[model samples]
Target chain A: MADVLLSAKDIKIRFGGVIAADGINLEVHEGENLAIIGPNGAGKTTFLNISTGYLRPQAGTVTFLGQDITAHLPRTITKLGIARAFQIPQLFLDQTVMENMLIAAASRQGYPSGFKALSRLPEASEMERLLELVGVRSYAERKARELPEGQRKLVDIALALALKPRLLLMDEPTSGVASSEKLEIMDILTAALAKEKVTSVFVEHDMDMVERYAHRVAVWNVGKIQKVGTPAEVLADPKVQQQVIGI
Target chain B: MTRRIKPITTAAVIFFLVSAVAPLFVSSWATLFALILAKGIVVLGIVLLLQAGQVSFGHAMFFAIGAYTSAFWGKYIGGGDILLYLVLGGISSTVFGLIVGLFVVRYREIFFGMLNLAFSMVLWSLLEKMFPYTNGADGIRVARPGLLGFVFTPETFQYVILYVSLLIAAAAFYGVQRYLESPLGHMLRAIKSNETRLEYLGMSARRVLLIGYVISAFLGGIGGTLVAIIQQIATPEFGFWTKSGEFVFIAILGGGAHAFGAFAGAAMFEWVRFYAAAHLADSWQLILGVVLIVIILYAPNGLIGLRQRYRQSGKRGR
Candidate 1:
């Protein structure tokens, strides 16, 4: 069995009487492409939030790399080799695309002397390599806001990869793209992830994309995982049919 | 529209020349000394804080802390040695910054700005209310220092000391610049752009912002201490909210494009204030207000915006 990169046991997050995440147990293995699929308000985003240290679970432990990271800060968690791309493509609108990537790369390296980073040299080359991987090297000089939605998503992915993270959490990675382009973005993502052997746990709504890309699918309903299995098994499950497919 | 000069670089170079070498040409000892130390150092602090996407309205608190600490130590504790006074002032203000920054960092956007103002006002009111320690409405005075156990009655040593202190303060402010332009600085900018996104990336916005806030406060203390040495008196008005507001104005005027924008803003402010005082002292406030309004409306990014506009237009023309 592949070593579990992230293990969550009975993690619960409550909003007053409503539980956003209740007794959710998930184990993400290294080098796996896992998709968490559910209807809106099924607690998929909440699980990602808790796991990434954005929203801490009120009860239960989150262990990453065999250590309890429940008490760790988000920056520390990121530094420990976990990076996330937001659903809305959180690029720095004011800065150039290259500058945004440089910031991400800087965070990974623990912030070297300012002058060294500012001077174009070895770090600049490294920046180019990452941009090339995302196929947006041409847009390097453009501000993030100027990039198309697909390109912005690419930039976000480049930023995540800049950290050289062991785990990549992507929230609706193909969001805002045309239905036809969604698969193409995922193809680009899969190729990039394969190149780095970076494990990805993504929350995606596209059933076709999930069937084609995910190694396993976990169906979430209300605030619990209704079913977890290989794409074929989980998609065929009656529970998923009622909660996710809504048949 | 491109001017062939980047605003950050232009502002930095201009301020550097003025602060570093302008005193050489100016023969008026009083004006030259004030230009180098009081105005220059205070403005440098403004530049540092604004770079981190924070605008301070409590810089006067640090400024006052520097003055008061120096006055108290020189008058009571250390027998008025100028060097000792500066050191003591810096130490006291740093301590003040750490305490105040902890509470202030919890706030965001406008609240952060207002909290700094409130804190400065608190310090100002406390100094005014505590008559015995601070001398209330009457400012406390510091005795002149003996030079290395030798008295220099002619006072040329004062000028040398002022210049040296200003140099060190300028260097310290530059250190802040180096940090801001670094990855850490980019991280702060990222927070400025989108704090929630930073959180999802496994970075804490609170921690990053807190460090920036503390650094700003620390330099504000240093600026304050420099002011104290020059003035020889510490008063409650040093902590006034208006003085804090002035730092904000200066930060904006300088364009906050680079570290020296604060200095440019401060120098212009002092120069204008002096010029107005000479010609129209009673209406100086009105004149200053109108100038600020014009700058804000015409140049929202201050001088920095002009630099950006030039760069963008140049690119287009090319």
Candidate 2:
């Protein structure tokens, strides 16, 4: 079996009366593109938040790289090589694309010391390469707020990649993007992720994106995993088709 | 890169030239200019916190602490050395900032502003009510401090103080400008942009904020110490909420675009007030209000933004 890069067992969380994550167990193996497909409020994002230390589950534990990290701070988890990209591009709107990339690269190298200028960061070449890989190199000088939705998504992914994480979690990378540009965004994203040799577990609602890129799919229904298997197997399942795909 | 470095170099040259030659030409304005420089230093501290997206309405408390610490050293410890007083002033206010920051850094926006104001008010009340130690509302008097063991006479005191204030302002501007270009400075801007994203990038936003707060307090202290020496008085009003408000006013007027913006704002404010008080007297504040309104509406980024817009329009015209 492939070594599990991230594992969560018996995870449970409640928001007032709503159970956001309930008795859920998941394992993401190294270097695999795993897609989580769920209806709205199905706890897919809640689970991702728990795994990334954004939300702490009321019960259950998350282990990453064989270390228990259920109570670690989000930054601590990030330093341990797990990075996340938000559904809404969480970028520095006032900063340029290259500046945003440099900030991430600086954090990963270790917080900048006193009087050490950004010019000395040593990540300029690598930042250029990452921006080029994600196809946003042309927009390097443009402020993040000025970028179109499709390009913003690409910049967000590039920012995540700059962290040099062993595992990357993406939440709805294509949701805000126009339908026509979804495939192109995913193409640049997946290609860059592969080239960086990063393991990814993404929550995606677009079935087409899942079918194209996900090596395996986990169907989440009402805070529980209904089934986990090859995309062909899960997509062909009658229950998944009837409920999730709304066949 | 050359384009960016050129402006900074030009600004540096102008700053040094003015500092070196201005004393000879306008020694009469030295006292007023020194006061502006001291306040500008405090506003520089505010600029740092503003970069982190945190505003403090109680920084005057640190200013008062710096002033009073220096006063205490002069009165009780018999420390006649101005350099030692400056260090003591900075250290005392930094220690206070470190302690208060532990609680203040956890709050954001209005809560942060209110907490700082509350602390400042408390300090103000203490200074007003403490009779023996602080000399109550009448305040404590500070004598002309000897610099490097050279006792300054009344005639030469203004020049010496002007030189010291200029030296401090230059150092503060250079240090802050360099810092804003640094990696940590980028992180500070990121904290304002999207703190959660910054944490996900692997930095503790709270820790970063606390460090910034402490540094700002240290600067405020140094500024306060200078002001106290200039005025030769540390009053209860030094820690008043309105005093803190003035720092915020200068910071916004200067715009937070660059470190030197603080000085620009301070100079404009001092000159405007000087002339307004001389001519308009009763209507000076009204004129100041009108000027601020105009700046807010036309140049919301402050004077720096106004300059940038002019340059851009000039380029377009060409």
Candidate 3:
């Protein structure tokens, strides 16, 4: 039994006519890769938002490491060792891939004031390794604006990895990726996460990806967790497939 | 143009040396050069603001604050020390900057710029209405400030001002260049690129911007102090909206690539305006307008961004 790293208890939130979260209870544990899968508007992203402090749930408490982080700002949550990657690549377009990774690494450690050169900082090599892990090392000097969508996605993931977080949350990490290329990207990302030994929670649509990469799968539907089990058991459940996977 | 034939520091050293001797060649316009260099310092600060995708059209208020600080020191404190005026000018404007930045840094883009314009206009009206203390639109006379205990005759004062302006300009250029290269400076640029990403990375974009804003206002003060010293007066016109526009104009003219670009842009801008006003006083503004349009059309990067489109530059800022 692994220790629970993040606990969301009796979480509830609503937006006008839509119920985003209704008493959603989920516990992400240490040393496990968790995949959250659901159809659109299933409150998976809203929950991720709540965890990252982008959206304050009308009701709910998010606890990380036994400390209440529900009201923390995104930056504060990041400092507490939570990092997130967006589905759409959010990057400093003018800076190079290497610079982006360096910034992410520097940001985690806390930025230095007073004329300290960024290039001379120790994060350079570490950032380069993260870039390599995500297979964007070859494009290190390429400006982020120049990278194609596929490469941008990898770089964005690399940036998240650079944060060196205790828990890493990603929103539809492979959504923009081509179906053919999704598995391969997931392989590299999961390998990097395994190497880093970071707890991972990802919202994914591809059941194949979930079955392959996720240690455990949590099926979400209409703002509620429909099922939670090992990938085989959850995917085998007829109700989850009908509701979430539409099979 | 080749981007890096010589390192920026080396080029700066050479440029400063040449500028130091420039007053001898153009002795007739020593005061003009001093004024231009001072404006360059102000534009240098604007360059930093531009990096954060923020623009202040009201920086001339800081300039006016610098000039007034010097004027008050001379009138009330009874001293003409240039060092004291410059230090006080920087400190006073920085104080104002911190106070204003606390409010303005919360906004971005047009709101940030408009708020600054609004604040400067308020200061301008205050300077105009406070006739007893401010001397109204006529302005107060700024007595010639002594430099490190030496009172130069008018004939020598121009040269002293030029040399001092040149020294301060060099230091400012170097300091700004260094600051822009630092991590904090990088984050300032990052704020422009994607503020959301910066926040998720665990830094407040507003805090970074405030730091840059205060520094920019301090530079504006420095420039204002120098201009007052050269002209021997501090007028409410110093805080006028048009004067703030000049700071923005020169910043755009120089491009935001590097600090030294501000100096080049300022020199070219002042000279063009001078000649235009001399030759065609009625439509000098028309000539300036044409030049800006041309610059915007062709060299969008300003004078410093002027280079053979290198591979290093991709799809840059929109």
Candidate 4:
């Protein structure tokens, strides 16, 4: 068995009268592409939020790298090598793409002192290289808001990669891209993640993309995981096809 | 290795030269120019906070604190040296900022602004009620401040204040410009853009803001100390909410993109008020309001933004 990099046991959270996550238990192994598939409002993103410390599960514990991290701040969790990309690109809109990358890179390097000069830093080349790896090097000097939806998604992923995390959780990596370009975007994205050897847990709705990239698939239905198995096995399950895939 | 001089550095040199030589040419406006520099320093403090997406309407409280600290030290403790009073004022304001920021940093948007206004008003009321020590609303008289150890004549005093204010303002401009180009400054801007993303990158947004708040308070204190020396008075009005509003107004007028914007805005503001009061008397504020509306409607980024746009268009034309 592969070593479990992240473990969430008995996670429960509710909002008002709605149960967002109910008694959910999940384990993500190292070096595997774990795809979380669910219908709309199935609590897939909520579960990811809990693991990344964006939301505190009302009743459960999260252990990462064998340490209890259920109550740690998102910053602390990220510093411990878990990074997240938002469903919509959460970037510094007024800043250039390179500035966004530099901010993320500089943050992981250390807490910046008042005198720590950002200009002419040795990390600029590395930032450009990261942009190049994500196939957005040409857009480096442009403002983040000026980029098209596809490029913005790539920049968002690049920003996540800048944290140098051991694990990356992406929320809808190809949701906003054109239908014709979805596969191409995923191809570049998956290639970059593989080259970096980073474990990934991505919440995606596209079954084709999941079939191509995910090693293991977890089907979430109404705040609970219905089944967890290899992509072929879970996709073939009648229950998953009827409830999640809706085909 | 040869170090390249930035345009800002060259501008600073030119500013210093002009301030030093211009005062000799127009000695009558020396005090007015000194007052502008003092207020400009305070505006620079506001600019820093504005850059971080936080606005403090109670910054005048720090200004008052600095002025009062200098007044008390000079009157009671017999420390009349200008430099010493500047240091004392800056340190006292910074310490106050550190304490207040513990609670203030948690609030954002209007709540943050209102809290600052509330604190400044509290200070204003205390200044008014504590008549015995603060001299009530009538304000207290500040003795003539000495440079180093020498007491100059009134003529020499004006020159001394001008040179000192210019030197301090120039140094602060350079320091703040450097800070804005630093990694910490980038974090500050990041805090403005998307604080959640900043945290997800493993940097504490609140901590960065606290550091900025303390530095801003220090700058406000220095400005207040210079004001006390120039005007030679410490009034409760210094801590008034309107006073704080004026700082905010200057910040908006100058824009928050560059540190020089503060001085430019202050200069234009002082000159506008000077002329408006001279010609329109009671209607000066109305004139100022119209001017601000135009600036907001046309040049939302203030004078700096206007200049940048013009430069960009000029390049395109070429």
| DockQ of all models, two decimals each | 0.53, 0.81, 0.78, 0.71
lDDT tens digits, residues B104-123, model 4?
Answer: 98888788899989988988
List, residue by residue over B237-314, the lDDT tens digit for candidate 1.
Answer: 888988888888877886776666666677667777777978996988787888788878777777656666666878
Query: Model 1, residue B146: displacement in angstroms?
Result: 5.3
Badly placed stretches (over 4 Å) of model 3 are: B1-14, B309-318
Report how far off residue B212 is in candidate 3 (Å).
0.7
Q: Compared to the true structure, candidate 2 yields what TM-score?
A: 0.97
**TM-score, every prediction:** 0.89, 0.97, 0.96, 0.96
Clashes of 4: 0
Return the clash pairs for model 4, or none.
Answer: none
Highest DockQ: give the candidate number.
2
Candidate 2 C-alpha lDDT tens digits along B98-169: 999999999998999999999999999999888889998888888789999899788798888888888988
| Segments in model 2 whose C-alpha atoms lie over 4 Å from true places | B1-16, B312-318
Cα error, candidate 4, residue B269 (Å): 1.4
Arranged by TM-score, best first: 2, 3, 4, 1
Model 1 chain A lowest lDDT segment of ten: A112-121
**Candidate 1 vs candidate 2, TM-score winner:** 2
